[model samples]
Target: MERAISASDANQRFSELLREVAEGESFTVMSRGRAVARVLPVDRAREQRSIQHLLKFVAALPVRHAGNWSRDELYE
Candidate 1:
């Protein structure tokens, strides 16, 4: 779960929060005891999404039969 940060604290330490978020730490900014916004690592999110999409694409690909080869060639 992402950690919660009150609006005031977020405002007071915006620079530090941004640095931490950029380093892959996520946070939910709260207001009046409720979540109002979120902070996340953009690069990490994009990389994770790209990797997941690539994995799904690879998984859906059809497997090809292996060609017959001599025992020595197979071992090599």
Candidate 2:
């Protein structure tokens, strides 16, 4: 579950918040009683590897052209 914290409190305890996030605790920053932002840890290396894999997969896809057909033929 994400903990809700006021924006002022978040700013006042930024370092503490970072430590909590590093320890896997998540938080949502609130402004005017409305959620505004989230703080969480991320695995940069894993994200980059995933993106690279996606790029390679897309690059290997075959490119094909539609055979000669009129707009009306497509609708039919």
Q: Can you write out model 1's per-residue Cα lDDT over 1-76, one digit (the tens) per residue?
A: 5799999999999999999987779999999999999998788778999999999999999998889789999899
Clash list (residue pairs), candidate 1: none
**Residue-level error in angstroms, candidate 2, position 34:** 0.6
Candidate 2 has its poorest 10 consecutive residues by lDDT at: 38-47
What is residue 31's positional error in candidate 1, in angstroms? 0.3
Error of 2 at 22 (Å): 0.2
lDDT of 2: 0.95
Clashes of each: 0, 0
- The list of candidate 2 runs beyond 4 A from truth reads 43-46, 53-76
Return the number of clashes found in candidate 1: 0
lDDT by residue (tens digit), candidate 2, 1-76? 7899999999999999999999989999999999999998888899999999999999999998889999999999
